[model samples]
Each structure stands twice: as structure tokens, then as C-alpha cells.
Target: MLYNRASLTNEELIKLYKQMLLPRLIEEKMLILLRQGKISKWFSGIGQEAISVGVTSALTHDEYILPMHRNLGVFTTREIPLYRLFSQWQGKANGFTKGRDRSFHFGTQEYKIVGMISHLGPQLGIADGIALANKLRKDKKACAVFTGDGGTSEGDFHEALNVASVWNLPVLFCVENNGYGLSTPTSEQYNCEHIADRGIGYGMESHIIDGNNILEVYTKVSELAESIRENPRPILLEFKTFRMRGHEEASGTKYVPDQLMEEWAVKDPIDNYRNFLIEEKILTPEEDEKFKDEFKNTIQEHLNATFEEAPITSSIENELNDVYKISSPTTIAPNSTTQNIRLIDAISEGLRQSMERYDDLVVMGQDVAEYGGVFKITEGFIEAFGKDRVRNTPICESAIVSLAYGLVVNGMKAVMEMQFADFVSTGFNPIVNLLAKSHYRWNQEADVVIRMPCGAGVGAGPFHSQTNEAWFTKTPGLKVIYPAFPYDAKGLLTAAINDLNPVLFFEHKGLYRSTYQEVPTDYYTLPLGKASLLKEGNEVTIISFGAAVHWALETLEQVSVSADLIDLRSLQPLDTETIYNSVKKTGKVIILQEDSLFGSVSSDISSLIMENCFEYLDAPVKRVASIETPIPFAGNLEKEYLPKNRFKEELLQLIAY
Candidate 1:
């Protein structure tokens, strides 16, 4: 053993050195595999391994890490098994995700590392939520999130920093400034002198260091990590480094200058650090050679073992099985009485019941606390649950959504409300990309409910009212529900809160007080994915959801046609069996929708009828939907845009046909 050391002993320094070297070697092997068509793609931070090792080494084992794809040294520092990494690259059954994901896309709960998505910038906000959980537990733990200079340009980067700063979360923001974001130089990307400057703008104490120096990287990060664990404030750390290889082996270095590559290659982190170890006599030349050889041989053994395994096979049934978690039915109390409640009040009651049931349930969004949400759906919740459980966030929608995802993954439940469904565009990334894909990707349940107040007839105009259910219907992993009645709204919201997956619960703004009924006062849950048969008829089947269901009911009374009115409470996991049977019985169908005609849910249901009930149809399926245009602000134009008259005319036309 050697004696002279700075901050870390000879053993630890040597260990860090070896950890950095192993990833470089593994990446080199991955390149070979790529050429042989064994692996699909490769992204390497060849010259910047010191940042991952230095930062991750400072974190305690259980403190979470939201690493980017290039941070392979983090997995090494955390002692992730090399064979498992190899198996993932080889698409073998022994991989962490059982070959469901590829390289840098598998996370292990045991390691506290979140598997990275392709769009990595959003993870910074996710890390904030993980840190928030630790803070809530008062566990004195912290999180370190990795991103690149290019990633800093993403809106999520700004949104995350703002939320972390405002919440005083214990998050270590590590930005690796590799000079380029997939060939776009930093000069062209941003006007700021340094990415760390942006963090300072968000109220974080910022630092910049030479990423090539392992000792400097470790010393600064270790100090800040401990400081934040004690005081619980975010720290922004910038590591200036260069990517020593192609973006991937296939995406060649033609765009990168040879002179610059040669300059950075000579300053390769592993080679320079190895020299530092030998020059300081921390390791003898012979010891260094033996260490490199041993690691290389171990990596070779892992590769061989991983390649010998077969790829995991998947059937359509297996893939679909994980789309949702099976919920045990909850029986409503037989002695409970129905109370006269508005739709909005019923939603508040459901929130109260779910929060009272689970201590870890969190309610957060703009104006949710104190202000009781814009629609008053969470009125009195802050008084009942306290500010700790019901939080009013800044207008950072992306952070709100992604942070909820982070909380759910850590065993807490979250109900995030979008003040208006139109603004969901701000948080669309996490909803579709992260929340919806979490279960399908890693069997990780994001027990999150996003409450959206939707519809056009509310006269809230374009920015506040939009029927965007069609957007989520295209996404596979989300459960979309739009309830028309107070009872259905309360029941569906309760069920969504208890579900072990992400759910988009759309509450129609127009139906908030336009209709009221007796709703169950006690805690209960309705089955998700089942439609309610409101009326029975024989001539034509009228199917709809949300505010349009009521319109269909009213139109049925005006028309002199016999029809069956079906309220489709859930848009996805569609009650297709109910719809098919109804169409078969009626022999003619009219699907009503409040959303625009272009790319509407009615088109999908119409197609399903055509595919399954073609022989039973007496005429072509009819769709009554709003005109394909932005919602008009004028009351008269808005009324004209609705399809109420069209529904009656379509019913008469289909009857005649």
C-alpha cells in the first residue's frame, strides 16, 4: 500500500481509477459489438469518466442518482454488476429489464439509479422529486443528477432548476460541458458564458471545475454533497470536459475537428490519472499494469458470459399485461347514503378520502393549496391535510408533472392537477414519455393521477378549454377517463388515486355545476374501463363521454328515433365489448364527440365498429363532432361550433338510410 494521498487514500484513489477505466474498456468493447451488429447503438463519455466517478463516489449508496446515458462510471462506482450491463447490451434475458430495454436504459431499485430515457434533460426535475421525498422523510439523503451543456438548453432544464431552488431540495446538479450537443457547439447553443450561470439565476450556489482532474472533481462534489445534506439547498456543479469519441461509433467524428480531437485525446482522463497515480508513487508501474490487465480480463469474462445467454422472448399478451396493474374491487358501504353534491365538490371529497386513507398521498399544482385550485376542486384540502401534503407550486408545469413521477417511483402517491387541460401542453413530455412508459419499460409503477379540467363549452376560451383526450388516447400506458356525472367523477377519481399506474382523469369544466345529483358520501371506488349504460333503445346507438354524453341524452329526447345512450366513462381500456354488442343490437350507430372532428376519439370508435360490427350495420357509422377549428371566443360562434344540431340531423339521416 502507498501512503501519500490527497482527500482519498491510496486504495480509494486506485479504486476510483479502476472504476473509470472499466467503463472506457466496456465502451470500447461495445464499439466492437456495434460493428458486428450485436449492439444497436453506443454513446460514450470516453474523456469525461472522471465526473461520474468523482460525483457518484461522494454520494452514499442509497442516495438516488438520476444519471444520463454517458455516465457509465456512475454504475461502476455504484458497483452495478458488469455482467448485467453486458447482458443489457446483448439484449439477453439476464439483463436488468430482461432485455426489455437496451444499454443505459435499465434501472435497479436496489442501486437507487433511475434508468435514463432518450430525452435526458427532463430527469433533472425528476431528481428534484426524489430529493423532495427524502426531505419529506427527513432522511438526510440527497440526489445527484447528470446532464450535458446541450441538454441545458431544454426547457425542462430551466423548469427543474427553478423548482429545486424554490423548494430548497437537496439536489446536486452536475452539468458536464462537453463543448457540443451532438455536434452543435455551445457558442451556438446559448448566449451565457457558462451553464452553471443559469443555475445561479435559479438561486443555486454554483461552481465550475476542471473535469479532467479527478481530485478536484471529487473534493468539490464531496464538500457540496455534504453541505446540501445538512442544509438541504441545491448546488450547481459544472465539469468542463470533452467527448473523446464519436457521439456514437456509427455517428462518426467527421463533424468534430481532428486538431481538437487530438488535443482532447492527449488529455484523456484515464491516461492522465494513471500517470498521476504513478508519479505520486501511489501505485508502482507494475501495479498499474496488473490493475489494468485484471479489469480488462474481468470485463472480457462478463462479455463472454453475457453473450452465451439467449435473448428474452416477448409475446403480445406479455407486453400488454404490464400496461396496467390489476386493482382489487372496493365495495362501497351498504349503509352509506347519497348526498346532494356538485361535480366539483364530489372531486374535492374524493381527494379528501384518498388523502385520509394514505398518509403519503401528495396533492400539488398551481393554486392547489390555500387557493384551493382554480376550480375549487381541492377546496379545504390544505386545511385538512396541511401545507406539507397539499402544495401550491410555481407555474412550472413540467417540473410539477415530472416531480410527481419521481415521488411515485419512491413509494409515495401523487395527484397533480393541471389548472386547465389546455396548459397540459407544458407538461406533455413527462405525461407521455416518462409516466406512460415507466411501467412498460421497467415494471415501475408511477402511481400518479393528473386531474385535468377540460371541455370547450365552458366559454373559458382557447387557452383554458380544450378536449385533448385524443392526445392521450394515442398513448398506450395511460388510463384516460372523462366522467359526465358527479357520481362517476367521484368514483373514477377515487379509483385513479388507488391505481398503481399513471391516469389522466379529465373532469369536464362545463359539467362542474350545470348538473348535480346525489353522490355517495362514503369512501368507495368504481371500476375503471367500464362504460355506464344510461338509456336502452333499439333503432340507433348513441355513444359519448364527458359533456357530450349529456348532449346526446338531450338530443335523444328531441329526436323521434329510438336509440341507446351509452356514457363511455373511460376512453382507454375502452369498453369495446359493450360498444360492439350495442351496435349489433341497434344495427346503426351515432358517435358524439365535443372535440374537433380531426383526429377525434369518435373516429377511433367508428373504425372499431367498422372492423368488428361491419356485417351488423344497416348504414355507415355516423360521427357528430365539433368543427375542425380553434374554439371561438364569441358565445354565438361557440354555440354554432358545437355538434348538437348535427347529432339530431345525423340520427334522422341514419334512420332514413
Candidate 2:
């Protein structure tokens, strides 16, 4: 069942058999290394090598490959040095990531192979973006992104597939249905009878193939890749294969049923293809044995050479080298203006001014170019900047973030917008692994701006409303900023753009149209890691950011309490100097956020203050945030769940004490 009835010539069959044997031998070597403790871990493609080799053979060497963790066969067939792979496994200096990234994260841009991202299903969106860029440049290259059957359950997979199909991008999505995702099988993951059936929802051409059949896989993928490269449409190839080993080296085969393993063993891709080759007289029994022996000897020599080389151990020093690409001498300054401004306009004007100042700034997102985005923050950008700079992208968050990374790596300042902050999870992998840590990992700076509309209110349901600042702020090497007023927005955003590190610019949707203030026409910048003191008071220090700062200010006005209000514009590089100084001056403090109090940014600030400024505190630091529940759709329930504007009342009670 693993082989097709179509006949192949002696030479063609020989090639297929050889390719399969190479991966099989390599996998066996890796498993031996793992058992000997020479390698840290192993994620083998033993039973699935046919599909991997076939897919790689179908594409040109110049085409891009964005593979998942189970892609050893693809890399091996592409002539990736076996020693370099062994070095990576042993955590050596000559490893693909220079010992900084994991084994599966290796890639070579010179070989036209984009870096591997291990996050499930996210790479598909990135592949779409790469294909789109090729289309824009009128390049003939196509992109292939591989994943597993379980990856289809992720939201990013659907988002990417829909966009690719709609835009007709030259992308091939290959899903290797290996039956198990760790312990959860494909039957438990989806309701569809076949993985290819889900492709209909995206209006893509789908194919179901015997993943064990190398010849069939190569022919089918070659035809699809060529067709999409010419017509530029999305194609989904679902290869039904089986995993011979457990998920990883750490996982034993105890969870797998004996009967299923036995059945799959009989259909071993390597052995079956070997039999096919001998039966067709493509390879004599002696020739097959000699070929394997030679291959094994070569792999053994490479493994020894790789192990003899010293392992990479100096990753700490390398982490500091790529924080920012262009180190501008200019540091941002704090805003001294007494005039107030709204947050939304500040972001728009900040982007506008930044684009005008720098010709390399490119902005893209859903409805960002012509529709001005869902918030109309970028409404007139297309008219002023033209289509090249201000472009509208398909609703593919993963692709959007990955494209931004690619552009930034090639000397462009990419400003990407996520229609809403809640949907950022769709692109979380690219942002966290690629954007946030690319500079740290690759010794290359990724200067990109991610603008996200966040926060709750206006009766938007749980899916639409969320304040996930804590998620990004927790990640190191990334700068996070949330401006409350127009002045702060313009200043902080300008600072973020000027920063060499990746910055997450979060804008509260509530302040987009409702809150307005006078912004300066002149250029101004705010310093990173500096907090804005809205009101200086001696009684208590009320620390907040984004929309909460405005609420904190209004509360002070109503309560008539002299409170020191600190607007923490930059979340990652916390302004400890300002916070400690204020906490030292005012013994009491109140931390506030639109997110839930538990594990919120406010909680982090409270911990910082308690750890560093505990002796100076007059009372325990209090926190006020939304209830620990999903945002409700009804107005009354939402209002009850969110932080009320009764901070003044609470402040009065504290002041009376």
C-alpha cells in the first residue's frame, strides 16, 4: 500500500532507494549517539524519510525550505553537512546555531533554506509571506513549509491556509500525518476523516499521498510545487506516514500499542523501498549492501570529526552582541510639555513622522494601508506613503510577523500591526522565538515594530478584548511600551522605533477615538526605561500604564489626594530608578492594570518594589485590576468585571488613614 502501481526506470528507482537509505542510516547513527549520551536528544523521521526526501528532491536548490523539527531527511538530502548536524547535537561551536540555538533550529540562508522555527503551525504563515515577497519581486522561487497532522488544530494553521489560498501565493504546505502528537493521536486531534479534507475550507488544492512511497511523493510534490510556482496558488499535501520511534528520545514506546507498531513496522518506508528497488532490478542485492556500508562508514567518520571538535560553550557573551542592529548615538528624552494628548493619534503621528524621517520604514497589516486598520490609526498612511511603504496584508498573523523579521534582516524597518492584541497568540511563536530572540541567538539585530490594539471595554467579547502586556513584558531582549496620552504615545513610539531591539508597541483601543489632546507638531522623543510622573505626591505612589494611567490621574483629581502617579511607558526595561525613587519618597503604593491582577504587570511591579524597596514602604502595596475571568459581552457584566473609576474613593479611604 505504501508503493504506487506506476512504473519507474532503473535509474529513477535507484536514486529513490539511495535517498531513503541515506536518511535511514543517518537516523540510526543519531539514535546510537543518543543512547550513548553523545547527543542530548533525538526527533527522528525513520519511517517518514521517504516523504521528506521526496519533497526536497521535488524543489530546486534555490527554493526556500521552512521545515519543522522532524525534517532530518529533508536536510540530509539537501546536502547539509552531517558533521555540522552532529556538532549541533553535541552542542559544539561548529553547530548550525553556534551552540546558541537547539539542534532543530539550524538553517542556512546561503543555501536558500530559511531558518527552522519549532513552534507548531506558525511557519505556514511565514511561508506565505515569503512566497508573497517572491511574487512582489517577480521571483520564480517557491516556499515549502512542513508540519504534522496535529498542527492543523492550531489557529495559525487556518489563518495561514486561508490567506495563502485567497491571495494565491506560491506556497506548498506539507503535513506529515504520523498518527501521534506525543501521546495524543490524530484521531483525537481532529474530527475530519482525512487531514486533506480540511483544505477545502481554505479553497486550496489538496492531495492525499502515501508518505512511505518515495517515488509517488516525489512525483506528486514536484508537480504541485511546479504548478504553484507558475500560477501562484496554495497547495496542501497530506502525507500519511507512521512514526517508528516514540516522540523523542525522552519518550519511551510504552504508550504505543504493540499491534499498531507491528503493523507499521511491516510497511517501513526504507525497507519497502529497498525491496522495490531489488525486485525491479534497479539495485542488485550486493550493490544495496555496499551502498549502505559506504554510507554508514562516511557518517561514522563525520560523527567522529564533529565530536573531536570542541563544543560551543560561550553563548552568554554572544547574547549581548545582537540586541540592536543600528546603534544610533541618540538616546530618547522625556516629554517636558504640559499639554495633554490622546494615545491613538500619538501612535499614528509617531509612525507618520518616523516613516518620513526614515525611508526604509515599511508598514503592513490587516486593513492597515487603505482601511487605516480596524482603529483607523493608519487611515491616510497609504495616500501619503504610497502602496510600497504602506501595504495591506492578508489576515495571516504568523506570516505578517515572519515577513517583518525577514524584511528587517535584509535592512528594512518593518512596522507590523496586529488588528487586535488578543490575536497576537496567532503569531506568538515568530514574535517570541524569531523576532524577540533572533538578535540574541543569531548575533543579528531584528529591528521591527509590532503595533497591537489591546485592552477591554465597549462590550467586545473575550476573544476581542484582552490586555496581554504581561506576556511580552516577561520575555527578555524585547522592549514593551504602552502610552496613555498622545504626548507619551508619540514620544514612546518614537523611542521604540529608534531602538535597535524589537519593540512591542501596545495601544489601547478604547483611547483610539474617545480620548484626545493637543500633540506637538515638532519632533520629540522619550527616553526608554523612564517613567512619566503625572502627579507628584507624598502620600502614595500609584503606578500604572496605558489606559490605567488616565484612570489613575482622574481618580487623583476626584479624591483630592496628593498621590505620586507613575506611568510606566516601557514594561520590559522597567524604570526601577523612577519606581524606587518614587517608592522611597512615598511609603505607600498602589499598582493597577487593565489585565487581571494575578500574574499581571502590576504584580511584577509590586514584587520588584517589595523586593528592592520593602524597607521604605509604609503599608503593603495594593493592586487593582480586572476580575480573574473572561471579558463578558454584556455592558453591565463587562463593567463589573473591569476596574471601576472608583480609585478616587479608594484613595480617600487610604488618605484618611
Candidate 3:
């Protein structure tokens, strides 16, 4: 705590000390509530208060900070009202997450605080996105993102570091190495000499800080932040601290050695800072005692008030509306004239006109820039837009998707292009847990479109050509779109780009070049979740999307009965109205899809028809899809494995029955 520090006045020093003390007192009371059964859980940051307080006090309140589970000091230091924080703990309606999440799991926009998810490393990538947005806007604002020693082992840690350094985004990645990651010691977490050394490898600067020393941290981080904002780039700071409590209250600290606790307890940040203040005659002993008493009483007062607020009432209707925002694409501003194009060209031209229409639309993926995508959907994007908007990311799928979430957190919308749809499995956690649940858990809208080029026919085999719409259509928050033709591709993608929720747009590799249509080359969008009625007949109905629709189209012509062919442009927000009406009109029906039969979109549609339109059927429903096996590489095996061969037989059986 003793150093020739920066010129922080005695008044500012006392304020910082008090800020550190407030969270300690708040947690102390919350621990009491936990014992009394008023609160279910409490993640106490009792020992490591100085890092959050000191680092936060140094940065401007308008700049963003992503706090970890133990960083209550960040909220208090930024003057986030105590009542709301207490409400969060009690699952009250007034909390930031509307009681959807507990403890420091929620972040408040009022304080520019971005709360981290359970998987900590992803937030680091998201912080990079915020820094990227700030740099693009020339806001001169920097961000402070925190992670733990255990989090350093995640692939996202390496991915985020490399991206931030290469892009030179202004971010202070503060790692609180508290010796253990839930009983795993720092010795096992990494083999390096120091965590700070990893920063050098990423071509970023590094610093070591004493986590318990309030004076040292405030002065050092204040200087570090000023330097970063002036010349934008990332710098890593390793704060050596100790977790005085368990990971959460219930997970006891028995794994942490008694000797280690004794060593860190002696370096208590609040006790040390208060003693230094008294030594310098900056504060009397009476004032120190008074500050403690005041904080204790203030926290109790807020706790009592928090209990008075209503607890979140359970309601399915409330949750029904929570999963997605109502669609409104009219707000988009881009415009263009008409042109005839291939399905692949419509995709390219749609994005070109979309970028022209929407200034905030940023396209990012591996080899997407100069090389174009592997499919060339983003061809000439780099030349058309600058490198900043047309970003070519490192091969880090998880980090790339999370970074898009970060961009959308700011005002910008992003187009996250996966070189292949099968590769999305790498980013599943962030998408399903973070992006999909974002709107349902919180009111925030994730305005980004994830483009996945999928489907079989090019013999890309199991790893690349699989159509996995079932993976997302079942997920509540995401909109899954799969188009079969050129015109539908541009319209649905534009709608997805303009959508306020996270969207999964699937493009068929088979249809990209093979299918051609004269389309409106302007910025336009078709109805999302609305099926295109390609043909109308009274005998039987066929519902299909993506490449399988073409197969269904060809197969239905061979059948005796006239059929209603529905090209379902999107999977989720499934045009239930169109589906139900079509099924009622024609008693016999078949649901066709490129994906395998087991647990696929076809099965769900079968269930939907059975549940809603069961009595309308003259015969049993049929599903025609690929066989339930991994796609074969042999060309003949691949040809036999697809749904096209079965569709004609299935459609004729339904009509004959």
C-alpha cells in the first residue's frame, strides 16, 4: 500500500477506501440473510475488494466494465443504486435481470456494467467487441474486462487475446489470479512462470498489480487507462489476489490451505487502507469507525427496503412474450434497383445492398475478407467495405460469435458468417445459452444475423454438408431460416439482418449456384416464419424447406394426386397458420427435410400436425427425410442416403391411403 502514488487527493483516497468497505458490509449482511433463508445463495468477494474498487475508481463511469461473480465493488464504486442490487439477491422485480438471474449474474445498463455469463472466458471476447465499437465510433472510451486464473485455460482466452492484440482494441484485460479456481490451484491452471507472460505472447503489454493494495491499484490502473485511451490498444494486467471465501457460500473453503488464508488475511485491503489513512493523519480513528458503522447501517436499510418490493411472479404468458421481439423490418434504410441473379449471387447482392442500407451491419468470419468466403458469398466484401466492417477473424468460432454479441450490445448489428454450418457446434454454448436466452432472461435484443451455409449435394460429407435446423428450431429464442431459391434467400436474410433477435440463417450449398431466380436486387425482406405457397392443390400437402423443397417439388409431380407444396422459408416461428390451413384443406400430407429423420424438424412438424390438426386427416401423416446415419462420403452412398428417393414413394402412399 506504500508507494509514491498518483496525485489522488486525500478526499478521493477516502472515497475509494469507503467504496471498498461498502461491498464487504453488504456481503456480511447478505451472509446473515442466507443463514436465515431469506436469500438462496451469495458469492462473497470478502477478501478481494481492492481490485474492483481501485480499478473501477480509475475509469470514467461512462466507459463499460464487465464484472465477475465476485466484483460487487464495481457496482458500488460506479454508484449503481444499492436497492436494486439487493433486489437482485432477493429475486425481486426491481433487479436488473428482473429477477431472472441471481447475485452479480446480472448487469445494469445504468452503470455501463456488462455482467458476465457463467462461462467467464466468453465475456473477454465480448469486451473486445465493445472496445471495437468504441474505436469505430472514435468515442475514445476504453473497457475493463475481468477474468479468473482458472478461466485462462479456456480456448476462448487465447482466441480473445489474439484478436484484441491484432485489432489493437483499447481494452484493459484484468485477471484476478486468486491462487485457486474452485479448489484447482494456480500451479495446475497453467505451466507458465506468470500469467502476465501470456500477454507478451499475444503482442500486448503486461503489468503486475498487488490486489490487496488499494492505493497501488488506483494509481497504476488510472495511469494504464489514460495511456490506453490516448493510444488505442489492449494491455493485460495480472492482479495477484486471494479468494477469502468459497466459490459460492455453500462451497466451503476447506480445499484452500489454512496457511494460505492466514497469509492473505493479514493483507486485508480495507484494514490496510484504513490504517494507512490514519497513519497519514488523513482520517481520525473515530472517522474510520463511523464509516464502518454507516456502511453497515446503510446496507441494512437497503436490505429491508428490498424485501418490501414484490418478488417475481411466475407466469407462462409473461414468458411466452419474452422469448422474441415482435418483427418490424420497416425500420431499415437501405434501397436498391432490381436484377436477375443466381441463389449464390442473390445472397451476395442482398448483403451488398443490406450493407448499403444499414450502416451498422458488419460482416465477419474466417477468410471472408480478401479471400472471400469458401463459398464466395462474401466475395469482394473487403474491397467494397473497409477491413473494419468486413472483419476476417482468427479460427476461433466461439470467440467470434461472442464478439458479435458484444457488438450488438452496443448499437451496431453484425453478420456472423460461418464458413460451414456444421462448424457452429463449436459456438453452441454462446449461441444457445448466451444469445438464445438473452431476450428471454433479460429485455435486451440481440440484433445480429448468423449465416450458416449448409446442406448436402456437393459431397462435402458429414463435417460440412449436414443440415442441422433441428438443433436451433427447438431452441426458443432463435429464428431459424432455410431458403430453397435465390429470391427467398435475399428476402429472408434481409429480414434476419433487420430482426431485433438473434437469427440462424441456413443457405444450401446445393442451391447456391444451381438455383437461379430473377429477384428484386434492392434491400427487401420476406415475411419471417412465413411459408411460401409454391403450389396449391386439394388432394395432399407437402411442407419442406431448404434443398429438400426442390426434391419435394420434383417428387410431387410424379405422384397421382395434386398437392399443396409449401416452401417453409423459416423453421422457427413456423408458419403454423399456413401449415394448419394447408393440412385441413388436404387430409393427406408429408413433411420432407434434408436432415435425418430422428429428432429432426420433420418429426416436430409431424407432432405439430398431430396435436393441432389431428381430426382433419383422412389418412396417417408421413415424414420423408434422410436416413438416420452420418452422411456417407461415397458418391453413390450419398445419393442413396438423401430424402429425394423416398419423397415420391411417401407422397404416393399418402395419396393412395
Cα-based lDDT for every prediction: 0.86, 0.80, 0.87
- How does each model score on TM-score? 0.97, 0.81, 0.98
**In model 2, what are the clashing residue pairs, if there are any?**
92-312, 93-312, 341-486, 342-486, 372-379
Q: List the pairs of residues colliding in candidate 1.
A: none
Per-residue lDDT of model 1, residues 537-622, tens digit only: 99989999999898888887787878888999999879998999999999999899899887889999999999999999999998
Residue-by-residue lDDT tens digits, candidate 3, 1-657: 574446878898788878888988888888888899999988878989999998898899999999999899999999878898888877788787776887887765668888888988888988888888888888888899999999999988888889999999999999999998988999988999889999989999999999989888888999889988989999999999999999888998999889999998888888887888888898899998898898888887887888888768968888788889776767333345566678999889888888988787789999999899888888888888888899999998898898898898877889999989999999888898788878767677887789999988888788988888899988889999888998889888888888899999999998988888778756777878889999999998888888888887777666666888999898888898999999999987888888899898888889899999999999888988888888887889998989788778777777878
Each prediction's RMSD over C-alphas, in Å, is 2.1, 4.7, 1.6
Better of 2 and 3 by TM-score: 3
Q: Which candidate is the best by TM-score?
A: 3
Candidate 2, residues 397-494, lDDT tens digits: the string is: 78678777655544567888998998999788888887776665655566788998988887798988898988888787788888887877887788
What count of clashes does model 2 give? 5
